[model samples]
Target chain A: MSKEFIKGNEAIAEAAVRAGCRFFAGYPITPQNDIPEYLSKRLFEVGGNFIQGESEVASVNMVFGVAATGIRSMTSSSGPGLALKAEGISNLAGARVPSVVVNVARGGPAIGTILTAQQDYLSATKAPAPGGFKCFVLAPATVQEAADLVYEAFDIADKYRTPVYVLADGMTGNMMEVVELPPMRELSELPSKDDWRVNKLEQDGNFRSISSYSPTAEGLQEMNEASEAMYQQWDKEEQRWEAFMMDDAEYVVTGYGSSGRIAKSAVKELRAQGIKAGLIRPITLVPFPKDAFDQIDYGRIKEIFVAEMSIPAQYADDVRWATKSKLEIISVLTSGGVILETEAIVDAVKERV
Target chain B: MEKSLLIAGFGGQGIMLIGKMLGFAASKAGMNATFYPSYGAEQRGGTANCTVIIGDDEIGSPVSRRLDTLIAMNEPSFVRFVDRMKKGGVVIVNSSLVQSKVEDKDVKAFYIPANDLAQELGSVQVANIIVLGAYIAATGILDAEFAKQVIAEQLGRKPEMLELNMQAFDKGMAAVK
Candidate 1:
């Protein structure tokens, strides 16, 4: 298909449909309401189902229910809304259900602004719920990448028997750009779920019991170990990141999502001024892209600037863990729904240079 | 080449649409374009703005620290965003609504009576289109024909409005020329 002008949220919705997401359940939330709004009509055209549940909790549970049936299911929300889905997400994790959740995050500790923010990084990567479960988090800096990530998220979720989050901010959700959408997957071509799906119980006498809890401690331990195996496999295989202008770089700017995109511009401007700068943009927050940090020439690299839209520096903690305190890390931060400024980032680098 | 533009006005003044048109046209002309809109709780009559960046290469930031062009459709918008323009940038002020003069002498300013031209063309809603036309003529960053095609695609759903909008766009271009 040719490139078409589309908003990020809408592109993600369309991509999900093309990826054979036949069931969608999400409540309305600012910055991400466009996802449900687009799907409410678009899904019907493809003989799919879209439900705007009474609340975020209901919506997530609905997606979980659909996912258990071996159907591609998805739900999306902003920060506070995503918080409400946390318990349901944990339920999906415990049940070993494959689902896609989208968090078009906004600024917040609680009920904050309806503007863009990356405050949910720790929440999405570390612990989505209480049981120490993690979702494979994919962060997209551009609308095209956002669509591409959402399309791939369903596959990753199914492969890992885990939920995958297309982590985006309101800036990416609200922005419009030219995107070449993915081609539609035929329903027949979709992967069959006969083995694990809750089907064939009556005819084939193959009973499948799906539950998020196990009564015995040993059973729960077995489930935990099984999940750990999958996570470890992802740790070795799923780390995704981008290194821009890293060859012979003395300074590095590290960020994810929209902040990463803005940092790229700052790197360009700093390079124009004869400052050897590069960018380390993490595409997957869960795998954390630690190898990208390893690729950095610590001998020549000076300061590593971490740019984020959150003031408390939630993403910086991951960057710290990845770099292992090899170099001094400076931060360029914006809070309370403020977009990260390229000028602020450039000036921060200049001060260190 | 990359150009960053800011279009600001009241909420009902179609500020966002003009920005979308520019971005759509740029993309159709085989350039990379990103349109970042200011979405808030405010409804119509509240301040509205959007930023558009068009470039030949991958666009790093959707928002610009210093805009290459500013199309201010109101007095407050003109006052609020004039200083964000680069030294050699250009601004197209809707003179009918923005009564103020350009304070930044370094930037080129075109005071087009967008509302007057729209009213003359029979609809006050086309004022933003007039400003869009002026922007195309002033900057020449995008092809005028591509912009006109975008107008027809965006506003042409209602066939009767297409010709009038085309005229408003042309008048806007004429005002700048």
Candidate 2:
């Protein structure tokens, strides 16, 4: 329960270390450079390994290598760097290696601005891999939540034997806030690697090989089905979200990450001004928090405003999917690294209702 | 209640440090605070600014459209953020570098010669501290003693610079008085 005022990136790195992550590999990218920079020193102090990989490609592979040893490992990147690691991420998914990847996202189509944007929502939630695989994507709206989710990410990754993602924007990565960090987990307290890891096979007299390739069509089909079943279980159990003042609301403003934070503020102010507005923030973006939308009384709701920092509204599609397009969806969007302003959201709500 | 402060200046003027100090002090005072810095290639010499929010509860957005306070260390920064100040918001300007006048009828403006004051204290690098001192005096947002203690703890590593920074902070407080 030690509390400290720290930057979001540094907080995530520290939380990961406390969660028993022993290996970190990353390259420098804006908004997320602090994660690797902080971990480079913090990891060594904990008797862990830190490598400044030559590139994102090399860094993710390094993570894959470390995860194969049954140690918790992580890699982080921003916009363009995330694109480079996509292949490795897909490979990690196919191999079903338990790893954590953080994307302190910035605006993007290709090499977009370095400012905060939720442009990676679609990439993070829908198509993180090539073979229709999904990631356990967690989007945090505050630095404290970011730290907590990151600390829990390791256990979730290990539990499912899959890659879990902490999808934050630049604002969440760079912002400084007071966070109560979790208790540190010692190296010896980590889960044993005897069952599947490639290490200590000689001692245990049990051999294991890790690979993404399936020899036959049946094998690949079985693998894909197992992955899909895991995703379904995740949707059933791992869905996390926050519903703010939705008991009797006419306008529901929905968002995630920094955008969600702003929209919540707008909703609060709008409520103060006698507007029946509330917020539905999806903390788990991959499972999509469809239940949160399901709980929304569409009969009482007039329109659902999907606020985000991406033009053409990337997360709005998920909102539509979650609600099954039963309610009218209005997108409040901005691109090119510009944050969604509170006034803009307030004005949007005012104009509509 | 939540209070949002924006500190703006040239890259070399310690704009980020001032915002961080306020955020740290707010957290130390048993309040929740958030400090968000804008970083890019422009960090070398171009304009740099950071937004800090302090509240009794969890802060929603780190970025604010209309701020409760704006500390402008240069002319460009003053012109850039003055319009973003909320009605009756406090505007602290470093008169040494910024010559603009605050004309907003609803704004409360304080002009302090932070650079000159820091020079008299024997270093222009402490100009931001001087402005911070005046800010504490003007807005009464943070206790002066608590802020000084934060400065001491932050500069504890560089023991040599501690005395001068304290003097600059005192001078800035005096300037506001």
Candidate 3:
């Protein structure tokens, strides 16, 4: 419980150590450069491996190589870098390797700026793999949440045998705060297995091989079926969300990461002036907490404004899937570099309420 | 609860240095603290700022909103952050850069001629230290003795500039006295 000052990005490095992560592979990029920089030195001190790969493409492949060894591995990058990793990421899914990728999201359609945007939601969770596989995504709002969720990411990825991503942004990643590091005694190493090993055996007729190609049609069918079932199970078992001031509220504002921070602050100042605004934050995005929407009686509430750093329009498709009890859903979206200010949220809430 | 301050000015004006030394002192006193300097282009010619947060409890947001305390190293920073401060917040202005007064009497404003003090000490780069001394003298958030300890620990890291930096810090602190 001792006090220490730390920035959000460096705390991810410390959390990686606490989470028993032994391998880190990443390239330097704005907003998230601190993560790799801190790990490059600390990995050596902790007897772990850190590789600043040549490019984002190389870093993604490196993630595949390291995680194949059944180690807890990770990589971080921004929007463009993430795009380069997407092709390799599909392979990771096809191979069923567990890796945690952190994206300190930045604005873009193409290299927009080194600032931040939540527009990556559609790109990440709905990554355009061959057959369409889903990746679990967690959005952290506070520096504490940012640090703690990173540790959670590694555990969840291994447990689900899927990629887990912590989608923070430049503001959240760069913000400074005191990190309450997990106790050293609480450290637990992630489980490692030999099944992913190639061409090795201790007994007669026991050699095994791993490949991206399926040797049999039936084998491919069975694997795809299994992947779907696993994803469905994740949908049921692993969804997290927080609803604050939702009880007896007329307006609900939904946001994540930096936008969520601004939302909370706006709510506080608005409450001081007597406006009732609530928040619903989805900590897990792969298995989006779609059910929580059912619990909301939009018949009573006047509106739901989706405020995000990216186009709030991205979530439009999902919002339509809501078993919606009649209510107007508005979007407060912005893009390119600047943080979504608390004043903006308050103004938006005032207009909606 | 954690409170944060952002001291902004040009590179040679000493805002970043003061912010770092304050954070160093807070850390030495066993308090949670962080100091971040905004470098790169901001350090090249225009304005520069360092954000510092000190806390007793775990801090949530490291960035400042309504600062509990502030030191505006330049006129633009003073004009920019003045209205953003909480009412009754203590703001130490470097009169060398900003000669104007706060329009309101609610906020406590201290005009310290840090550049003049640095000249008196025959060390103009020590303006940051002078501002720190004035901030400490007015707010008393950190003890002066604790600052000396901070100077010792932080300066020890850079062996080449240790003696001169500490001397500058001492002279700056004495000027406020």
Candidate 4:
């Protein structure tokens, strides 16, 4: 019940440790170094493993190695560093390993500014490695969410038999917040090391393995079938979102991460102007909860808009996919450290009205 | 409803601490709040900033253009956010660092000499709290008692500076009138 003033980055590290993550491996990157730095100090005290890898690639692989043993493991990075771990992420996906990865995203496309941005949206959701996989993405808009979701990330990764991303922007990571550490849930035991962990099975009878290459066609097909089924099942269990002030909403403002905060201010202003503007914030980006948008009564909505910290519009694409183009999707997308301001959103709503 | 406030200033100026304190206070008041700070250029001698949102309803967007009220501890923050403020919004400025005067008929602007006020109390670090005290006093959004309670609870983080902080807040609130 102790409340401690902590940075979002340190909270993530602490929460992961508390959530039963036994291994911490990561490479340092701006707005994210605090994650490894904090974990390196804390993991040892808790009798866990924490390693700062030579590179993002090696760090991710180190995580993959531990996950292979069915022990809760994690690694974190920002955009450019995440790019370096792509192959490793893909390898883990192919092996159906359960692990948590935190992306304290910064402005990107290249070595973009250290300021927060959601530009890595598509790349994160659609794993670009050899085998296609979509992570369970939780885009946290606040420092509290950044702190709290590390535990949730572990739970979801284990439940779905895939990676769970505690996706946050640099703003959320670097921010200082006196986050209430929620009670850690009793973790579900991993499919016992006797049976759950590979190679740990007695060499007498079983040859349990975690590998990108399954020697037999049947083995490869079985792995693909297993992952696909797991993903679909996860979509059902993990689809999460929050709809705000929508009962009388004439318009729905869609956003996630930092942009969601801006949309909130605009909604209040638009409502004060007698416009029924509400917010549809997708907390889970992979499962996306399209039904939430699909279920909205189009006749009640005058328009829909998506706001974010990217130029070409990533979540905008998800919004479009949800509605069948019944409602015209407009985006208040801003690039770099900036995001859509409330004034800009109000103007957009006014034009729509 | 969840309200989000972005407080911008220099790193050592306690910009992040100010945001975090507000979040803790909001939670103490039984309102859900989230404080997010950004480091990098903002902290390394650029313009450090953070956002704190508290509301009765779920907070939708975490980003804001103009705040319901702004506690600008520096000149750049005042320059960057002054135009974005709601016409009748509350703008609490640090008159010590922001030498330039800004006047608007629509907005109620309370210019507190935050740095000077804190220094008078023997520490300049509590300047952000001074500005926060001014925000509470001028806007009347938070009760002075609650602000005091929050200050006391958060004192452990900077135990040495607690007395100066309370005095700084007192001076700041007095300056508002």
lDDT of each: 0.91, 0.89, 0.74, 0.78
lDDT for A174 (candidate 1): 96
Q: For every candidate, how close is chain A to the native chain A in TM-score? A: 0.98, 0.97, 0.93, 0.94
Candidate 2, residues B1-177: lDDT per residue as tens digits?
899999999998998888888888887888899998887657566899999998998789898989899999999999988999889899999999999999999999888999999998888999999998999999888788878888998875787699999988888888885
Docking class of 3: acceptable
Best candidate according to TM-score:
1
Instruction: For model 2 chain A, give the 10-residue run with minimal summed lDDT.
Output: A199-208
* Candidate 3 segments exceeding 4 Å error: A128-130, A184-189, A199-206, A216-218, A312-325, B1-4, B12-43, B50-69, B136-152, B158-177
Clashes of 3: 0
Clash number for every model? 0, 0, 0, 13
- How do the residues B67-89 of candidate 4 rate in per-residue lDDT, one tens digit apiece? 67777888998898777676777
- Cα deviation of B103, candidate 3, in Å: 2.7
Q: Tens-digit lDDT track for model 4 on A237-297?
A: 8688878898878899988877776787788889999988998888888878887887798
DockQ of each: 0.83, 0.78, 0.32, 0.46
TM-score for candidate 3, residues paired by index: 0.87
Clashing pairs in 2: none
Q: Which pairs clash in model 1?
A: none
lDDT of 1 by residue, B15-38 (tens): 989999998999899889999998
